[model samples]
Structure formats: C-alpha cells, structure tokens
Target: MPGRLQHKSALITGAGSGIGLESALLFAAEGAHVLLVDVNLAAAERAARLVAERSPGVQAAAFKADVSKEAEVKAAVDQAVALFGRLDVMFNNAGIMHPADDNALNTEERIWDLTMAVNLKGVWWGCKYAILAMRANPTDAARGLHTGGSIINTASFVAIMGAATPQLAYTASKGAVLAMTRELAMVHAREGIRLNSICPGPLKTPLLMDFLNTEEKRERRLVHLPMGRFGEAIEIAKGALFLASDDSSYMTGTDFKVDGGLTSCYVTPQGEQVLPPPASLI
Candidate 1:
C-alpha cells in the first residue's frame, strides 16, 4: 500500500533537532520528499542523512535558513520547490525558548525581541512563502497531486494556559502564532489551503530540559501534568503528520492540541504508576 503522504513534498523548519527532525523523518517514511531547513547547516545535513538512512528511496535534503529573515525563508521555500516540483506541506517548527526569557519584569527587551523574531515572525514568513508556492502548485493528475497545501505552526499549551514559572516572551509569541494561523486559514480556506497550529505541552526536548535544569524546576511543572511525565518530540510529530496528510483534509483554523491533557485540568489526578512509554528516533 502507498503511504499517506505518497508523492507529496514537504519543507520543515528547525529540522536539526527536536520535533522538527522527528517530523521530517516521519514525513519521509510516509512517502513525502522532505527538505530539512535549519540555521545550523551541519545539523540539518545530519538530519537529512538520517532520513536517507531510515527511508531509502525517499528524497531528503538539507538547507540552512534563518526563518526570522524573510529572504532566507523564501530561499528555502524556493529550494524545496526546485527540488520537489511543488510544496505540499510546510511545517514551521523552528522556535526558541531563551534562557533569559523569564517573567515580564525579569525578561529583557533583547530576549523578547529575539523570541518574537524566531517564533512569531518566523512562522509568518514560512506561511507567507509557502502559500505563494502552493497557489502556483502544478497539478499532477497521474500522481493525484494538486494545488494548495497544509501548513502546520508549532504553538504551545502555555499560549492557552498560564505558567507559574513564566517564560512570558515564549508564551506571548506562541499566542500570536495561534491567532496568526487562524486568520491565515480563514483567508486561504477558499483557495484550498488549510492552516492549523499544533499546541504541544511541556516536553523532554533539549529546549525545555535546559530551562527546567533543576529537579525543583522540573517537578514544579511536572506536578500539574496529568500524565505525570513530560511529553516526547515523536508524539508531537505524529500530530503534525495528521495535519499534513489528507486525513485532516476537513480540518482548518483549529488549535490541534497534543498537550498531554495539560490545558483541560485545574488539578491533575495522582497516584498513577504506569505511563505510556516514550517514543524516540533511536
């Protein structure tokens, strides 16, 4: 049987590590040609190699692009189109949670600006260029391909709920992504383009692990999780896959939360011993 994303092409930002890298692998496994974009060219190249090793015959390449810079983002999108002939999925998954990003008062102007540049403005540029490419996408009747495509932005559960240990800039940037994605989805719905934000909860990714360095810091966030543990990047990648494929063809302008039930609870249940085993690339 053919894969869900058979014959499609996808461009994924921040494909060096974390959710971005995992999603690229999954998308390729599902039969999509993938371009892994990242500011770090070496890491992106490494990820592309992994995709090639894991999914033989699937096309995967690496490009260095800083999503905050419109020119670079446009270049990356153009590269994807050049390599794959059309852009079918754009996953704007590159983002940063700076160590200096704390509460409103403690966070510096530089930190907030940097976070917004990468997290908010980055998603904007990704969507803008991808939409333009998708609009001109050529039909491949024999392969069942057509114009317009899916766009998935990485938001966060913090956008919907308050965090006691506030990364104010990070939270605010994600909230903006949620709003921006919704409006874009509405504007492009008539053109067959679907846009949605994937809100992930606190995860054990290097980004969050660096922030929650101390046991107390980790526990502070963990106590509230109904699952009693942090989430894994692969879990979020699965959610992105659904959004990218025709499986979610009817969905648009939605906050698709794979948040480990974080947004739904005021107080989490206690005394659970067994939990779902974490998924990883290895």
Candidate 2:
C-alpha cells in the first residue's frame, strides 16, 4: 500500500539519536526520501543505513551540518533538493538541554550562548533555508508531485510553562521557538508552506534518563506527570508525522502538546492521577 508520505522528501536535523533518529526512520517507512542531518556524521550514516536496511526502496542519506550555522543549514537544504528533486518537509529538531549547573544566577555566558545558538538560532536557520527551498517552485508545474512543504520545529513543554527549577537558557530559547512559529506560519502561509511547533513533555530519552538517573530526580519529575510515566520517542514521532503529513494540511502556526496530559489540567488532585481516559470515553 502507498504510505502517508509517498513521493515526499524530508530533511530532519539532529538525526544522530533519540527522537530525531526515530522520526527519520518513521518518515522513511512512510515513503519519504529522508535526509538525515546531524553534527555526528557517523551516527547520521548509521541512521540512514538503518532506514535503508529496514525499508526497501526508501531513499535515505546522511549529512553533517550544524544547524546553528547558516551556511551549513543552507547547504543541507540544497543537498536535499538536489538529491530528491524537492524539499517537502523540514524537521528542525536539533536542540540541547542546559547543564545541571545551569541556573538563573549562576549560568555562564558561554553556556547560555551555546544553548541559544543550537536551540533557537538553529531552528531559525533551518526554517530560513527550508522556506527558500520550498519556495523555489514558483509555479504549479515546478512544484513537483507533492506541490508544497511543511516545517516542524521542536519545542518543549517548558516553553509553555516555567518550572521552579529553571534551565534559564533552554526555557528562554524554546519560548522563542513558539513565538517564531506563529510569525513564520503567517509569512509563508501564502507560499503554500506551513509551519508548526511540537511541544514535547517529559520523555524517556537518553538525555533525560541520564539527567534523571537519581531516583530522587526521577520521582520529582514523575510526580508532576499526570500519566505517572514518561513518553517514548515513538510517541513524539507520531505527533511529528501528523505535522509533516497532509493530515495536518490546514494546520499552521499551531502547537501540538504531546505531553501525556501534562498541559491539560491546571492541577491534578494531590494524590490522584489523570490518565488517558478509557476507550469508551473517546
């Protein structure tokens, strides 16, 4: 059977591991020719190889690029279009968490700058070139079979709500992402380009797991979660699939919260939990 992204070409940044890797594989499985971009060439190559090995006939390639750099981001977009004829989607997923020592009063200037460069400027750079590439096809005839494109930026739940413990730079950067998405969506809405942001909550990724290695920290995060468990990479990928596919054709300048109900309630009763409602509730 034909897949949701058949005949589309997608460029995903930060595809070295975690959600980026999972989403790249998922996009390829759904028939997208995926360009996996990462700072780690080896990891990107391995990811592409995994995609090719698992999904026969799916086009997959790896590129080493720092999304924070405009030249590198532009080149990646150019490479994707050159290889696949057009750029159908751009997933600006490259991001970093603040170091444990990062706090309001003690965060270093260098750390804050680095985090901003990768987390915020990176997405801006990705969107900048992705929009230029997507707009390359001025006419319907030149638009290729897919006709248009989509842009999805990775944001965090912290962008929406600030916690007592502050990763100052990370929180600030993500907040900017949410605002940028809306403006970009409006600017490109006429070009047949759509932009959206994915706000992921506490997820079970290597980065988070490593940070929460201590039982104390893990419980601290878990107690705030209504689901009482962290989300998987695949769950985030599914939300990404919606934004990347025609399924969300009319959606732009919107934020999807894939947080297991973390943002749904003001407060869950102290001892009670708010689970995904039963099947019948649907």
Candidate 3:
C-alpha cells in the first residue's frame, strides 16, 4: 500500500532545523514530493539531503526565500508546482519571535513591525498564492471530488490564551493568523480548499530556546507547562501530518492546539501535582 500522502506534493516553509524540517522528512517518508523552503539556503539544503537519504527517488528539493517578501513566497510556490506537478500542501510555517518583544509598553516599534511583517503578512501571502494555485484545479479527476488543497498556518497557543510574560507582538500576529485562517476557510469552503491554523505551545525549538538560553528563562516558561516539559519539534510535526492527509478531510478553520494539555489546565505546575488528591471512597 502507498503512504498516506503518496504522489502528493508539499511545500513547507521554515523547513530547516525544527518542526518544519521534521515535517518535511515525515511527509517525504509518507511519499509526498517535499519542497523544503527556508530563509537559510544551507539549512534548507541540509534538510533536503536528509530527505534524499531516506528516499532517494523522492522529488524533494530546497529553495531559499524569506517569507516576509511577497514575491519570494509566490516564487517558491510556483517553483514547487513546476517541480512536482501540483501543490497539494502549502505549510506556511516560517515565523519569528523577536527577543525584544515583551509587553506593549516594553516592546520596541521595530520589534512589533517585524513580527507583523513576517508572521501575519507572510502567512497572508502564502494563503493568497496557494489559493490562486488551488483554484485553478478545484476538482481531482481521479477522486471525482473537489481537489483543492490544505493550507496550514503556524499560529500559537499564545494566540488563544493571554500570556503574562507578553511577547505582545508575537501573540498579536498569531491571533491575526487564526482569524485570517477562519475567514479563508469560510470563503473557500466551496472551492474545496481547507484552511486551518496549528496553535502550538512552547516547543523546544531554536526560535524559543535562543531567547531562553538561561535555565532561569527556561524555568520561567516551563513552570506553566502542564506537561512539565517543552514539547519536541517532531511531536508537533505529527499534527501537521494529520492535517495534510485525507484523514482530516472534514477539518477546516479549526485551531489545533498541540500544547501538551497546557491550555486546559487551571493552574501552573509547581514542580508537583498541586491539585487536591482524589477523595477516597471511605
């Protein structure tokens, strides 16, 4: 039997050293022709090499493009279609959290501007181009169904829940992503295009760790984690896989929070189970 995404083509931005890279590898393993895109050519190349090592015949390639630029993003998607016949999955996963982005009062103007440019506007460009591509081929002749594709935007749990240690700009940009995703999902529902956002919690990615290099920084964020640990990049990649595959054909406009139970918790971890112990039936 073929893999879940057999014969499909996927373009994943931020496909360098974290969740995006892991997802590229996993998608290739499942038989999608993966296009590994990133701002760093070297990083994207490294990821492409890894995918090739696993599946030599796979049409995996790498492209360097800053997601913040409309032309670069459009060109990347066009390149993927040229190489792989169609763009089946467009994963707009590129993003940044500037070190200076704290609460609104403390965050600098530059930081706020940069965050919206890359996170919010970048995702908008991806969706715009992907929709244009998908619209051209709305019905899969083989399946005899609407053949539009999946557009997965990387939002954050912070978009849904307020953070006390506010990366105000980051949180705000992700919130816009969720809202845009829902609107796009509604507009394109009949066009067969499914749009959704992945609202991930604090993962142990370079984007998070580079700022929190000190143990104190780590603990300050980790204490609130209900799982009591930072999630691995691969763990989040699995969620992307489900969204990309046909298994989630009915899913759209949904914000899938892969936050290790953090969003549901009423209290932060105090290095122990602080909740009252289950009452004994005496």
Ranking by lDDT: 1, 3, 2
Clashing pairs in 1: none
TM-score of 2: 0.92
Question: Mind giving the per-residue lDDT tens digits that candidate 1 earns over 1-282?
Answer: 899999999999999999999999999999999999999999999999999999997899999999999999999999999999999999999999998899978999999999999999999999999999999999998988899999999999988997758799999999999999999999999999999999999998999999988999998888788888888899999999999999999999999999888888876766778376554433
lDDT by residue (213-265, candidate 2, tens digit) is 67887777776677777888878888999999989999999988999887775
Candidates in order, TM-scores: namely: 0.97, 0.92, 0.93
Task: Give candidate 1's TM-score.
Answer: 0.97
- The runs of at least 3 residues in candidate 2 whose Cα sits more than 4 Å from the true structure, single-residue gaps closed, are 138-147, 267-282
Give the range where candidate 1 is weakest over 10 consecutive residues by summed lDDT: 273-282
Which regions of candidate 1 fall more than 4 Å away from where they truly are?
Answer: 274-282
Please give, for residues 1-282, the per-residue lDDT of candidate 3 as tens digits.
Answer: 778888788999999879999899999999899999999999999999999999876888999999999999999999998897788899999999888888968999999999999999999999999888877654566743346889999999989886646689999999999999999999999987999999888888889988677888888777778777777788789899999888899999999999977788766747585443124301
- Candidate 3's C-alpha runs over 4 A off are 138-140, 143-146, 273-282
Higher-ranked by lDDT: 2 or 3: 3
Alpha-carbon deviation at 105 in model 1, angstroms? 1.0
